[model samples]
Target chain A: MGTINVSREYSVKEKMFLPAIIQGMIITLKRFIQGFIFHKKYTIMYPEERRNYSQRFRGMHFISVDENKVENCTACFLCETVCPAECIHIVAEERDSASNPYGVRKEKKPLSFDIEVLRCCFCGFCEEACPKDAIKLSRNYELSILSRQEGIYDLNHLKREVKGRG
Target chain B: MSSYEISKSENYLNYCSDKIRPLPVTGPDAKPLPKMTLDGQVVEFVPGDTIMQVAERAKVASRIPRYCYHPGLSIAGTCRMCTVEVEKAPKLMTACSTPATDGMVVRTRSEKVLKSRSGVVDCLLASHPLDCPVCDKAGECELQDYDYEYGPSRSSFVDEKRVFPKSSTRKLSDKIVLNMNRCVACERCVRFTDEVTKTNDLVMLNRGWKKELTVGDEDKGLYNDYQGCLSDFCPVGALTWSDFRFQKRVWFLRGNASICDRCAKGCNIEVHSEKEIIYRFVPIYNPKVNAHWICDEGRLSYKMVTNSHRVIAPLLEVAGHGPTATSWETLIPVTASLLKNSSRALLVLGTDSTMEECENLRKFFSKFVQNGEIRYFNGTGITTSSENKALDHLLRQNDKTPNTKGVESLGLKPLDVAGVNGFDTVILFRSGRAGIPSVAAAKNLILWGVWSDEEVRAQKNVRALLPGLATQEKSGTFMNCDGILQSFKKAVEHRGYGLDVTRIIEKF
Candidate 1:
């Protein structure tokens, strides 16, 4: 069977495309002039410029710490239980009484706290469920990882100092 | 009373309230007991039952809150949590200590009773640290539950809570940690040691506001076999099991009913686990078996399955270097060939094995070995079920194996130590609780069932290893020391490449 070409002929306005090209150029030039001269930029220079997020924005997770720098987490498992994505895994252990001066307040501590950022839905349930106000989400959304293992933030990683919501 | 006598006694009581006591279904010939009006519902009760017991028999005991009214311990009406409004009585009477009379009327949740409970809770909370975030007993603490149900939302007293400075994190013993600030002064632990264990290891020191719990013998320090029971019945986080202290929160644990296989007493237990990892074993109330308490050894027996050294995969002895971890595909054929080629094989089943496993192994080995003899071994010193005896006054048995009586009931003979020499190859099967028999005479040894790395390494003549599931990972029936048949379902999934006995036999 022969191939059928359903081609239609162009009108004068379509055949003469200089006006259309100039119209597109004019819009580009308007944006360029606005960005360069007026400094009204629409896109950010990402590595240097960042978008301002609200205080409640949920991103990477972290464990809160006290003035002594010891984690405030009592390892109550409330966050693990409330996590909708089931990404949080924790192992709790008693703080050595010899080293722990806070007595009953800092008695129990997390032996291992892991959060699979890849699996986490960033729902902020963990932050809400945490009784000790330990687990929290920061506004630092730079979560790109080179490997799968990097996505799993461990106790040491989560214990990293985060100033407020960062 | 000794644990044996406690188990045999018809009037065995539990730490729980009588509300859990199921009333006997009345038959035509059954004697009619006196009736009492409990919460406007007419309920029959035994002649000597207290108001609390009557409520329990009526299955409405939950309506009454309790602090020091454990069925296993003597009544101490100090907390005043179980007070009820009696129709004729001008004052609210304590249900635990007050006996029920014929045609007596009681209101368990009257406004007066609720006000009384709220008062008691308020007093308890006045001294309570309320550090539930770090308390191990947070989810199961009666103080927390009662406070939620009947306590006043706000407190009247604004004074700083009483703190037992030194005793706040005192080590009562290696098994228990005492946080004095969390104690509600229920004195249940004191009563438990005094009445039940009878060791009198713990005592309430001082009077009123300054009251504190201290070990009777400070140097000896809570040296009772049943110390774990103290933590089990403790209504608050005052007494917490150290093994489970910070392991996991109680709310995250999922409990499944299983029997403690550490001893022949076979105390019924609830295996508390999360994600197939056991956290602890708490005794389930079985009046005829273990009544609301298990020994510390049994409670901590879950470590055998969770031990890091436990061999989980098939191991094969290569180049006389010893057993090395290998896959089932390669190990199964080697195990089958070894069994098939052996001239005279001896299958020594550890008495810790369930009756089903013992019988299954016997049948499977008989088919696999042309000239084979199947025998049971209890290497915890006892050779026969008749030789087994109670080690303690409580539930601990001298016979460490859980099913020596069970294996015997299956018509299997005990392993003759001298007879182990005649066999060319010996297959030693156990579930980690049974002691290893002296089978050094056997030239070729095939280790099967839960074996730790150290246990596997000790054997010089071992050929291949077949790792198997522990008691918590499998379902089976065990005939306890008393010849009582108790069956348990798998408490957790086997976190290993180990196959069931039937599955292993099928591969053979």
Candidate 2:
């Protein structure tokens, strides 16, 4: 077969530029109009405004109990042990002997339970490991703190919210 | 001219091109190092080694103090006195726990590090009682030393100091005394007792200001044989030995490294002594052997040597009455005559006897008695059936002797009481009720033990009763259950008829 190499070359004058440039300008002009006039504003002053959360959303943790308002935590230490980051520290003491169902006394109760929010990864492991369904990540997400020490949520803070919810 | 010029030009250009290209250099291995400087001294450390360990290895002139970071224990990283500044890290990091990395700059003496360290020291002091005057661990206490070196002048805490109700000063056992007020909650003693002794007797109780170290339920005292370790492991004056408490300050005693004769575990120990008297025995760190712990049985074994009930002089048998105190010169010949005349003389030895004494007795018996037989007996019974399997598993046999393995290693068989009918004469090496079997069967007995048990002392057939050196009175080796040979030095001289068995056997 006789090879026929098609080679075409033209000076700058052969290329059409006006229509392509016009098409690009039209697209840009349309975006500018949308940005200035048609687009809705998304910005809000964060401190003054708040965001809505779903009913099932997991946020700052809170301990909840049954209808009887009894503390659901047995202080089994399963949640503390399962936490990948050792941010949860639980110091348990024995519950009142008369309150236990087994008639046998225990050696532990949560005397001081603290969760370092700064160190927590919020993976929901604590909630998953709680057999008693005591500790839960609630829908309240306002968890910012000004100081490192303030981020360490103590037992008093946990029990207060837990009592309110219960 | 044109041909020569073209050829030269081509060759020169080729050489120039090759010369300009980067060539790899072959040399000796490059010494890998970090770009950090510590206390103005350039040093190199392997990546991931802590700054404290690196500074220590480099011999840097910096004091990165620590309390919870013992070289022998797992780093608790509680005491933050070793804080040092890193060039890039936001806050100063504790030198004892922080890992060193390549190109990471460290400054231990920088103003920031000093300020942070002083702040930690001040906070630690805020809760501390600062009762160094009467504290037993005052001179040697790590807190006292650090306070003198880097502590702030005073604390600003104006609140009434948190006071824990002093738990009834309880004796955990015969060897240990627990003083709760002096505790700093370092948790070293609890960790040592739990991890090393494997005895879960002591644990941390409560939380925050109410935290204290306590044993199990109120009635169940610390009954473990390793209870004395709490005293040795306590960095503060919290746990003290009943024997050594209030006797003398730790600074007054000079420590000499020695080995324990209690068992075959060959626990290395430090004999703290003053005025030629042993105060206490503390376990020294030996990775292959006992790691910073020893049995309470070993710690209290020093009492036997210092007791007034020891034998001080040699004795010989009188005709009608019991054995009379005689000179060493006369006793040896008299004993030799008795052994030489007897046809079926038997030598009975206590398992507590040292290897040197056993060997010497074996040699002396061979020469002194014409046709005598030698037998071994351990002085204590071994009760092994228990749920505490760790302690039971440590018991080698029913004999609670320290050197039974050593005697067995010497090819001498232990005497079975059931097999022996009777013998003409039997010799006792050490005192214990366990040696009564041989004493009862013998027609005539020669006792050379330190403590006088009623059975052996009252036996009418007993011929000559001589006092011999106890384990603590002599320097000798003992083979423990694990077949590890440990040597103990003479803790003190015998008060009564105590003489080294090696020397006693030499007389015969």
Candidate 3:
């Protein structure tokens, strides 16, 4: 692979400082007019205004729960299998006989479900692969954290209540 | 390699039922071979042939779907999946139980047959958990394959499905795990336990929608020697072998046909491996041998090959380090010198040794250890062919080693513990099937075959350990219990430091 990048030759007039300076000023003037004259804003006004996302927008993932507050996941591992980034890890165990009212219908339960979101590609494949509507990528895209450890979401973090892909 | 095979018997039962029902041969009394037209192809079949059998003979392009119609098991055509449209017949008939008459036109893939099959799949899937992702049988599940081929786009049942509370995640035996929710009530496992092993360990309780499979005796859960076959024949994710459950997916495995060496039965098996790591051993259909069923001991025998303690590397008895793993270059010259120095060398070939390996050893020793006395050793207690008999009606034999008869046929004497005394250097050669003999009389003992560190440590005055390939890792021929010669190619590459007989001999 030879470098073709060096072959492009700029005309003497365009290479001179004036043309480049004018192009830079034009971008700045357009942005200034849009912000001040038209009152248009590119950045969100945090703590006040929130951006609405489409239903299909893939973002932070959460597991859904049924009316009884029991998780919908039977630990079938479809999400883990379909996850392209290999961010999800799960360990399954049989539900305890004493507490399991659903019986063999919900026999298997994920003992621990962890998702290292940093490694996740936000692909929504897990959402599509899940037989039960348990794992879903929510519309809330604000996934920043203070530390790297917080980016790895556990079952507890995933089980928190979220409404309608939010 | 595919879901249909994992769920179906990899080999159709080749049990020739002719011996059991010996009809009269050529004469006016003898019945002519019946012919049937399956999918427009006419073929001749035996007098009492099922539609599926006729279809097989005709080499029909479309395979009739089946759930409880294992060729190895007695026919219980309850699944309604194999229903086919027979010309002049009013309704669809199950090909499994329906016998084919001469000139019968069977359409396996007609629209009517396909529609009925789709309806059968819907009924079977109504209560099914549809949990294929976590299922060990996902890739090879018969239900999954049939559903993809002929099932309705979605289930119609609106009501909640029935659940067997205690049946899911049930341990039928130490080897088998039963998930009743995944079961489609095919009753194949129940029949297998009843007719095949004759253990009667599994029984189906209740009726209709409330049916459940439970152990015959609650106290004893699946106490059969052939419990591994349940997992092998199950058409769904219901019955799974505990040894292979959740270890690896079925599609990811690479199967190589090999023979089991746990016993003299020489059960043919397919080594299911992924990345050279064996997942499990499933019996391949050999009507002459195992016939689609492998004992749990033979099925679990792959663990021995994959064991961490197996002596893969050549070990030398270092002065301070005990048996230390050393390269062949370092140990080969030393072993050669030991043979040269010893005035009288005795070679003890294990009964488990293949015919070719034994021949190579006999020739190699006669040339190398010129003053050596060669003897074959059968470590599994039984001394001769007269003592070797069937331990069970099935595959197992009294002689545990696979090739006791093979070595005996070589005109080698059995090791008489008292007669073989005061040898200078004794070489114990085996393929890990024979027992380690008490060769205490020998001044120097060289351990060969698949020896572990623990075994080498137990023996005294052992000079070196020449790690050799197990039966699965090498190409050789073993004479089975029935005096049947079985030649097997190397299934998987030798994962450890072990070498075959020829390779080890060349090093000498």
Candidate 4:
């Protein structure tokens, strides 16, 4: 009502530009000095110093067994059929004796099993599709081979690894 | 001066992009342009050419192993033995189905690709019945070779194996046998039925472990004229002919390239024989002609050559008496005397005669016999239907003879059966008595044919019935309806002393 002049009001404080600029520059300088002078590298050489994997880590594969050391697989082709790349191959045989009834006597056994490591995308589909918990991805990823012919994991090789792990 | 300035302006205006430069206009009557090349080799290929196809054209040694990718049939990428390493691709690709691009770098035997292929061979052998000793396709099978090169030393399967019924034991029809145990299921036979024959008679049935092949239950069954193609198309010992099943291993038989003699089609075929006995006939690929198949009738026509019923020697009959076995020397004199003494001599040529024999006979009779009259006769009736008619119609023509058109091509006119007058002497060629009623009516009938049908030989006035050689016993050319001249070699000699018709006529 009194027609107060509200336009362009200016306030002033004591100038401290030099100290504020110095503080910012000091923080930058501290980082630069720490990077060059006092830096102790934390990067680990991968093959020479292996990293600890998580409990659920999936890497190279192995077959699992029950307490009796008998193979847990029923020779069901679920893993082989469900593999998108068709890398998993299993030869199944009947393990049942003539005496048992209820059709339970017929147990499927893996006569010859192989996983083409070269063809594997490591998608964990074979492990996921195994109904008997026979095939599992382990925490070992050293699957390199001198020749391509040696990359195909055969039944004997798989059985030995699985037995050692179990 | 003004024209030069205008041309310069035009050239400046035409320059837009380097890639879009117009090709120089050659004269209209120019010769064919030279083919382009890559890496000092000619680059010639159509669209959808596979890496293997390009490698073949370039004459590059490709190590891709294929079980199902036969050039004669549609591509079935089932067996993964042909894995190849491609530049910039994450995993190895199958060379059979992988298209060749303008600058694609394909490595057939790279370490990664070899590993993948070896893995495939190992996997393929996991469930494969290792019955090579007893398996019919043992020596020739591709799986056996791939395993020898890239497979594991021993099978890991320790349990009682899954046993499928052997296809050799299962009879699908009178013509086909199915041995399921040895099938790699490359689907070549299935693809052949679906693509080339278009009959859809065979089908892959069941799923997963229980998969098998079956034919329809219709009365015709797998009785398509191209049924023998399945046996040839089978890479494994799955589909075999009942006629050839357990008879002889394929390795035992030596294959000779021959043409089918069942019809005027003259389909290219391979005659598999041993000890001069033809055991089987399979089709050979001729793109301009029979693509990859021949009629079942043509396949079985080999039997006619080796059948025990075939006449093995020349037989001569005394006047009005039953035929007596005679030497060629005795028959030659009888035939020459009959031709020379008769007032009117008639030479009735059969359709099975080769072009050489027909032409030679025409000339021989012209010199020796009076008036030298000759007529064409065959067991199958001639029809006016076009040669390119539907397959069913063509098969029903009943023209069992192979060289009707060959004889026709040799300038022999079809005899007007209705206008034939009685002749004093007649010499019959190789056909049985099916087409000629007038020839039988002739006075002195000197029958020089393979064998007499019971009715024709019993006719009165027949003087001499001589058994001549069948088609297999002679080598000559047959010009098919399409004018393709196919030459067939003599498969074997007749058991007795019967001279080839060409030689007999030449001697006369």
The global C-alpha lDDT for each of the candidates, from Candidate 1 onward, is: 0.86, 0.65, 0.82, 0.65
lDDT of 2 by residue, B17-67 (tens): 121122333468645555457776777775556777677666552367776
Q: Against the true structure, whose lDDT is highest?
A: 1
Name the regions of candidate 2 deviating beyond 4 angstroms.
A1-166, B1-64, B102-114, B153-160, B168-176, B197-200, B219-223, B319-321, B382-399, B418-422, B431-436, B453-458, B495-497
Please compute the TM-score of chain B alone for each predicted structure, in the order given: 0.94, 0.79, 0.95, 0.83
Better of 3 and 4 by lDDT: 3
* DockQ of candidate 4 (2 decimals): 0.01
Candidate 3: where is the Cα deviation over 4 Å? A1-122, A132-166, B1-32, B219-221
Tens-place lDDT digits, model 3, residues A1-166: 6766557777998779898899899999999999999999899987598887677889888999887888888777778877889999887766776898876567668888999999999988999988888999988788989999998899889985678868
Docking class of 3: acceptable
lDDT by residue for model 2 over A23-55, one digit each (tens)?
889998988888799984567667688676566
RMSD of candidate 2 to true structure, Å? 34.1
Give, for candidate 2 chain B, the lowest lDDT window spanning 10 residues: B1-10
Q: How accurate is candidate 1 locally (lDDT)?
A: 0.86
Candidate of highest DockQ? 1
Q: After superposition, how far is residue B492 of candidate 4 from its true place, in Å?
A: 4.1
Name the better of 1 and 3 by TM-score. 1
True contact recovery of candidate 2: 0.00
TM-score of each: 0.89, 0.62, 0.83, 0.65
DockQ scores for all the models shown? 0.67, 0.01, 0.25, 0.01
Better of 2 and 3 by DockQ: 3
- Give the runs in model 1 whose Cα sits over 4 Å from its true position: A1-40, A44-62, A119-122, A138-166, B1-31
Best to worst by TM-score, what's the order?
A: 1, 3, 4, 2
Error of 3 at B125 (Å): 2.6
